[model samples]
Structures are given as C-alpha cells and as structure tokens.
Target: MIRHQRQNYDWGINAEGSSLEGGAAQVAMNGDTVFIHYICRDEDGNMVDDSAESEDHPVSFEVGAGEITGNPLFQAFDEAIRGLPLGSTTVLEARGGDWNRELFFEVPRDHAEIQRLEGRYKNQGGLQDGLIVELSNGGSAMVVAVTDDVVKIDANNMLAGKRRIFEVTLLNIEPAQR
Candidate 1:
C-alpha cells in the first residue's frame, strides 16, 4: 500500500497550461497512468529538475507500479498522485536519504561516457574540476577530480539527504492500458 499526506489544490484555478481544470474528472487511482509536469527542488530551494525543459515532456507513469524498486522519489510521487484530481497542481514532499546504491556511484575517468564528455569540451581547455557532465544514459554526474590515471565522478541523485519539494501538475490521467 502507498502512504502519503495531502494538501489539495484550490478550486477553479487552472494549473499552468492545463485545459482540463474545473471540468468533471475522475481521480487518479492505482493501476492508472498519469501524465504530469513537475518541478522539484531541495530544502534550500535549489531547482533539481523541471520536466518542462526535458526532452521528454509530459512524462507518464503508472501509480503504485514501483517498476524501479527502492526509488524514494518514485514512491513519493506514487503517494502524491494517487487519488489526486485531474488537472490539479499539487505540492509533493519527500525527505531523501543520503545514500542509494543504485543512484550514488563512481565510474572510471576513462569510461566511455566520461570520455565522450571530454571529447565534447576538448577544445574548451578540456574537462575541469566541478564540471557536471551530461551522460548519454540521460543521467548527469559531477567531476570530482581529474588525475593522470583516473577521474572521480559523483552521480548521486541531488536530492539525497535533503527535504524535497515537488510542484507537480497533474495534466491528465487514464486507465492503464494492459
């Protein structure tokens, strides 16, 4: 079962760019697919990610599917969206742990992805310390240090160990197909 808290949205006000607001609609339930756009920030109010700027906008996920087990963000989102009205903009909160084996890990400097980043910025004085490089896998990592033989990279989710605030707009919801 999913556990969560709730602070429902105000009535009659539309979520940004949402055309479904104020219309009769069913609430999202488990086994339903939800379309959403969200902006997440940490305790310090630093923007973590804005789905609007992502290549894949209006992302969809199934509530309670837990396809990626042990992901707290996913769990929190499942908690937030379940039973939420369509076309509502809700604030979802979660406290992240400092460590997650799947998210926090290091890779060799010579790793293909790192090398690719190095190649991209080669003419620009090469890779530098503290440069956050975008990975081909759609993830990002910070360059801890670059040494003669090895580079240190920290690919931890930025939300780890911090209070998270997700302003999630529920654009639409539909029954999960299959």
Candidate 2:
C-alpha cells in the first residue's frame, strides 16, 4: 500500500473547495433532499467507503437536517451542497481524530441508555459487540467494549486521527414540499 501525504485542515467543516459540473438551473436548497455519490479515502489512500459499491449509493438526505450525520465535518459538507446546481460536486479534506475526546463513556449495565440500546438493537444483533448506537448528542458510536457490569462506547470515527478525503457529486435534488 502506498502512503499518501497528509494535508492540514481545520477540525470541523474544512472545505477544500467544490466544482460545478454540467449546466443545470436547479440548485440544491435548504429544505431539499439531495442525492449524492461519494468516495471516502484515508491519507494512505485506502478506500473507506464508496456509495456506488453499496445499494445505499446516491445517498439521499434533507439538506437542512443533514446535521444528522452528527459531526462538524459532515455538517459543513451538507452545508456546502446548498445552492449547488445539479451535477455539481464538492470536496472535503477532513483531519481524522476524536473531535471530542470525551466520546468514551462507561455506563452501568442496567442503565436506561444501556437498556434502551439493548431494546433498540435486540432485533438487529443485540449489544454484544460491534454495534453502532445513536447518541443523544446526535453522533453515532461503535460498541468497543462490553462487560457484565459496564459497557464502554467509543464515538470516535473508525478512521479517527487519519486525514480523510471525500469526493462528493450531487446527483439529484428533491425540492421542499410545503
């Protein structure tokens, strides 16, 4: 594997730039749900995710509510799409690291959060291991460690501490209703 050079950027919402592709009068707006194809790679140029490879490609989400992605980096990415016409694309080079070091939390095995998580994930696979949970703060975290008395959850991105390269193309936009 070839290691790529790392680039410096602000912690959250560090937008490198964006380029509009074809000529389209329609521009992504605040309430519109935008569809986009994206590829994520690490500084080493390793592919983290590609929307095209999965059935979830051309991901769709409302521009305003995109903050559901739950990170300053992603929030900025969603914000960048607003006003971009169809066929436009954007680039974000985010530095990988625990945006919040406090992401590690240990909760009692019988805590409400733990119970709720167990109930929510029971059908999927239960909270045994490697389960992703939605945080009250809106960020998502992976179950890193589990024990009889306590469960340790880490909200850090899997690629934390590594520079990430995101190339996103705006495929389509659904206008707001009402």
**Where's the lowest-lDDT run of ten residues in candidate 1?**
10-19
- Which tens-of-lDDT digit does each residue in 69-113 have in candidate 1? 666556666666777877666676665446566654456777887
RMSD of each: 8.5, 6.6
Off by over 4 Å in 2: 1-11, 20-24, 67-70, 98-156
What is the per-residue lDDT of model 2 for residues 1-178, given as tens digits with 9 covering 90 to 100?
2212222345543554444444546888988989999888887889898999988887888887756766676676677677766776667777666556687788898999889888888888789778888976688898978999999897888667667878878899889995
**Per-prediction TM-score, please?**
0.57, 0.58
Top candidate when judged by lDDT against the true structure = 2
**Per-model CA lDDT versus the true structure:** 0.70, 0.76
Q: For every model in order, what is the number of clashing pairs?
A: 1, 2
